[model samples]
Structure formats: structure tokens, C-alpha cells
Target: MTTTDMLTGALAAAARGWHVFPLLPSTKRPARPNHRERDCTGTDPRCRAGHTGWDARATTDQTRIRRAWSSNNPSYGIGIACGPSGLVVVDLDTHKPGTEIPEPWNRFGIRTGEDVLDHLAGARGGTITPTYTVRTPSGGTHLYYTAPEGVRYGNTAGTIGWLVDTRAHGGYVVAPPTTIGSSSYVVTDDRPAAPLPLFLLDLLKPQRHTTSAAAPKRFDARTDRVPAYVASAIKGEVAKVTSAGAKQHNHRLLCAAIALGQLVAGGVLDERTAYDALTDAARVLMARGCDCTPIEVDRTIRSGFHIGSRNPRTPGTTRDNSRKAA
Candidate 1:
């Protein structure tokens, strides 16, 4: 596409209330540079006080959009920041060479990412609703779905199903008319973005111990409702809460309670046991001499637990890492 087309596309996206940014000319990468704090010399105006990444610099204000896209590089392509736009764009990717579809999906003859998503939707007793869809230059599809109210999802790679990825918070997608060489990403479906399906949102729900606890501990309720694996998760989460930094103490405690509370809802842990574990863990914060009182800590924990109990996540739903990158 030409400069005029790129600029117009950006303005159009901004008009739709989606924050837009300029991608590098003839490329999918962002045109704006992301400065790092340790590498900062404090000379540049944007990073004078601290670092500012491309995501933060994204804007929808007409004046700023015009200035940014028209400045040194008018040929820049359009990019939509999915988070600010309240979007969770599911990337149905085409399988590249040297890749193979894993089992379950493989047995069903699932070839591309679209097929994987379709299969997943079917398994969940639903269908892919009509929404704004963009066809990538590589024969893949970008299904734009509005994120749930007050919920934030992050970028996932092959987690939902084989070849299926999602871009939400901390991610961006090249918009239509953004060309890669001679091929351009085109909007195949012009419908309004649909609300992300509830089943889909549960699949994207994030766990607090992405670093500390790698996976959800699995167990068979037939033999034992609460196994030693669940015990480990509890210990890890409690450790995170008690050892959290001064500002993070309350938040961490709440998150831990919520996580354990999910297990309680799923019948994997006793509610009383989970509460007692977390309450004892919160005592560590008090011992560390934080301003927090017993009542406030108890309230935060109870609130978080109740919130989590509302959305029960069964243990071992997040299995099959081997199938990732399929």
C-alpha cells in the first residue's frame, strides 16, 4: 500500500477508538524505537525521565497520529495495540514447513490454525462467531474479539491449541493494508468485533505463579481429593505471598488466596484448609512490620477467594505442553 493508504488506515482505526501506531516502512516491526533504562543517556525527550516503549507511545488522538505517521517516515504501516483497543485478537496461524499437528487435533485432520480453533470451538459446543477478521499475507487469519469487561489477557503461544495464539495485553497486530513485500494483510470480514466467548476467556485466564509454579498440579479425585501436588502449589503460592515486597504484600496475598480458592471450588482442596493456610501465610507480612492490619489482610484474602470461587478452574486443564508449537 502507498503512504496515503497507510495513513488513512491508521486514522480509520483510531476513529474506531482503537489506539494505532506506525509500523516500520515495508515491515511489520514498529517504526518507533523502544528505549531501555540502563542504556539511557537522558538526551532524548521521550526517554528524558525514563524508558518509553512503542506500546506506551501508541495513540488515537488525531493530532498526534498525524504527526507520528507523517514525520520522517510517512510510508509506515498501521498497527493496533490490542489491549488499549479492548481487543483479544486470536491469531489463526498457517502451519509453516517443518511442523506437524499433534494428537487429538492431528487425529481430526486439523491442518491450519483456523482448523485448530474450529475444532476447539466445536469441542466446547460452540462455533466461531462472525467478527472482524483480517487475512494475513501468509494465508493466516486474525480474528478480532473484544476482551471481556475489566479483564486483561496476555499474549499466548500455542497454548489454547496447536498453531493457535492470541494477542492482547503487551501485544500488537499489523492492521489491514499493511503489506509485507507484495502481499498485504486484508480485512476479509468487515463485521464489528464480537465479545470474546466466555469459554474462550476461561482458557486465557492467567495464573499468578507463571514463574514460581510452572504448571497446575493434577490429581484424581477418585483416589484423593487433595493430593501432595496440590500441597506443593499451596506452599509455593504462600511463599510468594509472605516473601513479597513491601508494596506487593497485599496483592500477592490476595492472588495466592484466589488461586487456592479455585481449587476449593473445583473440589480439589477444602475451603477451610485453603483459608487457614493463606491466613497463616499473611502473618509473615505482619511480622515484617508492614502497615497492613489483620482485618485488611483478612478482607483482601476473602474477597480474592470469593472472586476465584466464582470461576472454578479444574486442576490439570493446562496439560499437553508437548503439543505446543505444533
Candidate 2:
């Protein structure tokens, strides 16, 4: 499409209260540089350079939108910032590599966008509610929904099965009428973006509390001793493993290993102690009918420990912790 057509589509999107920004021609990346040679590239928005990113440049203002598109690159594609636009787009991808398909489609039924929609519809009593949908340049579909009030949903990659992604807060999606290669993103359903269904909303909700098992704790060790928080976190992981189902047993064990590795790297737990503790923890699961082999447990712990040792918990500390010992 021509530059005028692209700008017109952008302006039209702006009219729909979607905060629009200019993308690099035929690409999903922003048109502006995120960091200049001399400017601060920190998280501080006030110190950012001019139009450094899509989130900063994204706006609904007609004048600003026009200026952004009418510049040297009029052929630039349009991008809509999800949060500002009050949108949560369910990106049903079709381009995932064959090796990455979680389930064997030949054995189990192939999951498609239609199947997902059907499942949602079935949960809501057989009526698949209509909303604004976009057909991407690829065979994938972008299902747009009005974001839940007051809650900011962030972008999630591969969180919802394989071949599915979400574009929400801090995320931007290419607007319709933008062509990439030979294909174009076109509006399939021209209706307004509908409110996200309750069932889907529940799935999208941020998991806060410890439901089935205790949540994994992030490693933060600034003091010489392993903090109470770190100890408690390890305990929680152990508890999760002991109580985890057969399906979750391996994952919970891996998480515990990683945590123990972090503690070892931070000088909280010695290497031998970490290994013994992890082995004992795994034993608890094995006693409770968990099917994880001893070899898998040892391998998981060793791999995690190696990684944590390389990137120690202490900030700015070298890979070698001998200096601290000295």
C-alpha cells in the first residue's frame, strides 16, 4: 500500500481511541531509536531521548500521529500500544516450528484458533461472542478484546500453550492495512472490541497467591549469611515438591534445584550441603510415589548449580568467588 493509505489507516485507528505509533516500514520494530549515543538509556522516562521507543511515541493525538507518519518515512507501518488503547490481543500464532509443537497433532487433535474459540464458547454456554478480529499477514489471527478495568495485563509469550501469545500492557501490535512482504493485516470482524469474557479473564488474571503449591522465590542475597527469606523460600519449594502431583513433580524439583543453586552461589549454602539437601528433598517425593529417577534429579541440580555459579547472586561480583573468600 501507499504512504497515504498507511497514514489514513493510522488516523482511523486513532479515531477508535487506539494510541498509534509509527513502526519501521514492513517491520514490527519501532521507527525511533530507543537510545541515542550520548543519552541515558535507564528506565527513567524523563531522561529518555526523543521518540526512543514505541510506548513513548504512541499517542492518539491527530497532530502527533500525522507528524510521526508524514516524516521522511511515510511508508512506515502503524503500531497500536495495547495498554493505552485498552486492548488485550490474543495472538493465535500458526508459525511455530514443528519441533516446538507441545503435543503430537497426529496422535491428539490439532489445536487451532477455532478450537480455542470453541472451548471458550463451550465454557460460556455454546455462544462464541463476536469481537473485533484482525487477520495477520501470516495465517494467524489477532483477537482483540477490551481489557479488564483497572488491571494492566502484560505481554505473555507462550504462556498460554504453544502457538499462542498475548499483547497487552507494555506491548505494541501492528495495525491493520500494514503489509509485510506479500501479505497484509486486515480486519476480519469490523465490530468494536468487546469486553474480555470472564473465563478468559480468569485465565489472564495474574496468579498472586500460592494455590496448589508454594510459589518459587526469586534469589536476592546481599548479606553474607543466607537471609531468613531465602531459607523460607527453599522450605516452600520443598513443600511444593512433597505435595506436587505426578505431572508437576519434575518441574517442582527443577525449581527447588535452581533455588538451592542460587543459595550455594551466594555463599549461603555450601556445595555439598546444597547437593545433599536437594537429594533429600527429591527423596521425599520419591517416597511419596513420584516417578522421577535419581539420575534426572542429579542432572537437574548439577546443571542449575553450574549456571548459578557462573552468575552469582552478588551484583558486580566476578564468576570466581575466591576473592570474597580471601
Candidate 3:
């Protein structure tokens, strides 16, 4: 088999364990449904019913707020991808207003079963620790982390993720996809100071919801036509991973590859051959040591709409609850 074929085969093999789905080539049809055109409702109880874009989470205008996390995929033994808007919690054990801790904020206490890691670094007046922060397409921020094992993913309750009693509930087994510090998640290459040292005091002060940013004029999902800024950011990430020889799980690489594939299908690719490019990129990322279970890869690519740039997540958005799946 060709190198691409060999890599694809290997990725397929690894996916069987992790639950990753392959990025299938779309039929070249003139009227394919836009992945962005569907409502998240009905998929799960926590899905914001009737909401199409990011602003559906809003009740009023000035109420917009956003949350950040200490780190991504904080598992110790098993590695998890902590997918797009990983911080947002969708399930909250059916909590109500005034009871809801805001989805993302509650995940620490709920899913991972610990207080959120403060991202602030060096505030202790000692040596600083490296920090990375990245903005998601939903206008939310994802703080990746390296945490102990027992944290996991679940599809119980018809949601993609929910905190199930790992010992008793007997649902999906979730684990970190790689080692902490080595594979937590990528924030910005800017390496902002870890925010944990400063915010670690209250443990719940920082809010997880943010108002959606106004849609940019002339937005395009085409890989080539992607907003210059977004394109630059993606390129920068690619460069950072490549230059540092960063390794991730197959799930992460697959999510990224599928994202590129969808973008290509949407006419965003500079090159017309998005399927081949995606497969090739997956191979390259895998070659670089990015690792993930096939299950994780499959799960991520099938759920690529979450990677969209226009649909910003809101603080207290229904999806932010830990009761919801990741």
C-alpha cells in the first residue's frame, strides 16, 4: 500500500479501540445539506432547541460572558480529546436556574470530579509555568489540562458526554488520549501564563459562559476563503505542532482532518482535492506522533459541526452543563 493508504489503515486499526470515525468523502452533489444548517435540538435533551447559530444561548444582549479552563484532557491514564468547546458542559444532572453552575464551570466538579484548574501561572511569585490558551470557533475558550486518571467520556442519557459513576453507572469508558503536559490540549502558541495560580483561590469565580461575538461580515467556510485571521490561526497551529513535533491522539488529528475536509466540501479549500488532502494530513499528523483511538477519531469527525468558527458558545448555554456530553 502507498504511505497514505498504510497510514489510513493504521488509523483505522487504532480507531477500533477509541471509537473514532473516518472522514468519508462526500458525494459531489450540487445540493448537499449544509452541516451548519441543522438544529442541535432533538439530538439530546440538553441541545438548545430551535437554536441554529451561536446566539441561541442568549436571553438578553448585555448578559454575554465567557469561561476558560485550566487545561484540556486532564486524564492521567487514558487520553481524551476534550473536543471543541471542551469546557462547555451540556448535562448538569437536570439542574435549574440559580442551581445551574454554568455548564463549563460545573464540569470540573462534575465530570472530572475536581475543582477547575486555575489557568493563571506564576502568580505565586515563584517561577512561572507554561500556559496555552486558544479561542474556539464558538467564541469560547478551551483550557487544556493534565489531570489524574478516572476522568472519562460518556454517551449515557442520549447525550454525547455526561458524568457517569465510573464504577457504578456502567456507561462509556472515557480516558485521556495521551499524557498530561504532553497532550493536554492546545491553546494559543502565545503561551499565556497558567491562570491557575491566580484564580485557584475561589475555585469557582471565573464564569464559563460568554456572549457570542457578532458574526463577521462576509464569513466563508471555504478553506481558501476562510477568514484570513482564522486561516492564519489554523496555520499557526499547524506550524506549532509541526515545529515542536507535537504529538496528539488519532482523535485530535482526525477531528482536524475532518474539519479540513468539511471546509473543502464547503469550498474553503485552496485545492479541490479535500478528501485526499485530509487523509494525507491525518497521515502526517499520525507520523508526528499524534495518537488516538479509532473510536475517538470516528466520534470527532462525525461531530465536526462543533468546530465551526461562527457559532460562538455562550456562558450558561445549555451545552455548558457537565450533565451534558462533551
- Candidate 1, 1-326: lDDT as tens digits: 77778878889889878999888877888876644657777677777777776787889999888887674566888889998999999999887878766898768877899888766654543335557889998899999988868887899999999889999999999998888899999989786676675347547884321111122232223325358778777777888887899798877887776677666545556555566567667766666677776667656765565555544656665422221211
lDDT for each residue of candidate 2 in 135-254, tens digit (9 for 90 to 100): 998788898888867988998886654566889989989988998888889999887776664335656785421112223233333335346655565667667766777787767666
Residue 123 accuracy (lDDT) in model 3: 21
Which rank order by lDDT, best down to worst? 1, 2, 3
Q: Candidates' TM-scores? A: 0.61, 0.56, 0.20
TM-score of 1: 0.61
User: Candidate 2 versus the native: TM-score?
Assistant: 0.56
Q: Least lDDT summed over 10 consecutive residues: which range in candidate 2? A: 208-217
Cα deviation of 17 in candidate 1 (Å)?
0.8
Candidate achieving higher TM-score, 2 or 3: 2
lDDT of candidate 3 at residue 51, scale 0 to 100 = 30
Off by over 4 Å in 1: 34-38, 206-326
Residue 133, model 3: Cα distance from true site in angstroms: 36
Give RMSD (Å) of candidate 3 vs. truth.
24.4
